[model samples]
Target: MVEPFRVVDLADWTRGESEPGGAEEKRWFTAPDASSQSGRWLFKPRRIKELTLSRQRRARGDAPDLLVRGEDWAEKISYELARLVSVPAVETELATVVRRGTEEAVLGSMSRDMRPERWGWTPGAALLAEHDDDFDSELSRGHSLSAVLTVLAPMNGPVGTEFHSWPAFDVFAGYLVFDALVANTDRHAHNWGVLQNPTTGVVCLSPSFDHGSALASGNGDVFRADRVRSGAVQQWCSRGVTKRFDGGVAVGLVDIAMQALSLASADARRYRRDRIVGLNLDLCDDVINAAPNLSDHTRTFVQIAVATNRRRLIDALH
Candidate 1:
């Protein structure tokens, strides 16, 4: 049996920095861990502001609804699932944040910074913009897979001992595969990028991050239950797409992932498919079942969605 993730209380931890550009609030702080490199972690609370609202709800004598948006557990579970398939991804942990004077604490996930010391993190939009003078990083109009691949083909995989010989495009294909499995529809141009060493002027792909938008995290419990009861999870997963790619047209997650894989080397393609083919459903169930603060409906819906998409990806890849 998989154990529940321990929740780190950050009420006393001093906020060191703030992260911008996302709809939700984010902060950077030094993690309590000793082994972490850089010691910097990003704290992103769940999309909903439940702490203050819950106090008001309680004052009104109503039930306080916690786990608003479910992104915290979604992020942690996605991290574990990524490990199951050997996808190099940023590590995330369940955490809580407290306002300075308030006793109420907001629940969130803390993502370990993937950037190595002295390396600069660059987003895909910036890379595309640099690659083509006409490309606009702010707009999604020109963020196509071909353009992304053309830029990645000449680069190396993420900077790590394990990724020494891997090509950037190869690892990127795995990222798409992971995205398809999770029904992630938010891989916009700003979502992915590379890390560059200032001294050597060397660049490499960065580990996948920012998965709080996956696994239907933004939807409420009622929506998840309705979809599961009506047996529409698979259909819903089929419709999940990130329009930020391929000229902003809505493309199915699985379709886009398969398209990316088709452009990769044969060995890399085979590796991704084999990982899915050999995946154990029970292990996935353990991960979901072990997740904290999830409703029964959410557990059932995510399990079915993953299994459904797994079948879809396997069929397409085979």
Candidate 2:
């Protein structure tokens, strides 16, 4: 089974106070080359990831790679999209970012005190000292796979997590539609998870996180038509869809839902298999049906993804 994990080290990034309680925040860091540091950290854990709002505001042409792409709604939009698409990720919540006082920075807690062994939490103390001079340059491998699984995981589980439990047919189909409408392309390893609560016996996947890349005003890597044109490539590289904030106004809610329809159509193979990835399909259907409160636009998007998935689900569920 895949183990539970969180980021304990921030030495590479600035030593900022995470949100109250356990909500992690991005701690800014200076790049070895001050200018280059502004780029992006290709691969990162979504729960503990950080980006500069101020830097995003200062951006010139294309949106800065590291900033939350949308405004305050970035989290809201992405979270709803995940629910619609049926991908699993961390719970999304707003948290504060604070630069730790010098005393806290210098006389940090010891690693042993932080308990790196139990729960697999790396100590937050020494991270400041050991982090790279160029912190943002670090990229995680297999981000492509991460993106695909964000919403379309195999339900068979990735290598790290062996337990697999996708839901009943109706539920899985509903989420697929939700994700397609939202166009959540940033489905990488750092954002999604596979785990269960022991007492509840519920092997639930986390809700979506790090969806700041959706619905932008310019062209982004994820928004490119060529990426999903070839059915095989969309299925094969479905795992790595980190959006580069490339969407123009044309690709908003309407465009995204349409794109999802086409993308899913190209590779019915993957969509057909992923209908019940994380939860029971019955529960999924219940959630979608109850979500009548979702905005009309969002609802329309879900309808499109689900309509196409129903037939496939019936054939497979039997």
Among the numbered candidates, top lDDT falls to 1
TM-scores, all candidates, are 0.91, 0.31
Per-residue accuracy of model 2 over 1-318 as CA lDDT, tens digit each: 222122223355333222222223333232234432332221222231234456546664444444222222334434433544444433332222223464332211111111111223211111211332322212432222123323343233211222123332222223334444344454333434433344543333433344544333012323333333432222322232334112211222323333333343333335534543333444333433433223333333333333333333333333
RMSD of each: 3.8, 15.9
Off by over 4 Å in 2: 1-72, 81-179, 196-204, 217-318
* Error of model 2, residue 307, in angstroms: 16
What would the TM-score be for candidate 1 when compared with the true structure? 0.91
| Model 1 ranges with Cα > 4 A deviation | 33-38, 49-67
Candidate lDDT values, in order? 0.84, 0.32
lDDT of 1 by residue, 1-318 (tens): 678888877755657878986776799878554434347789998876343455666789885565468888889888988988888899888888885666568889998888888899889998898778878655576688888898888788888836647989888889899999997888887889999988998889899888898899888788899999999998998888878786678888899899899888998999999998988889999999888878899999999988998999999987
Looking at candidate 2, what is the lDDT of residue 99? Answer: 36
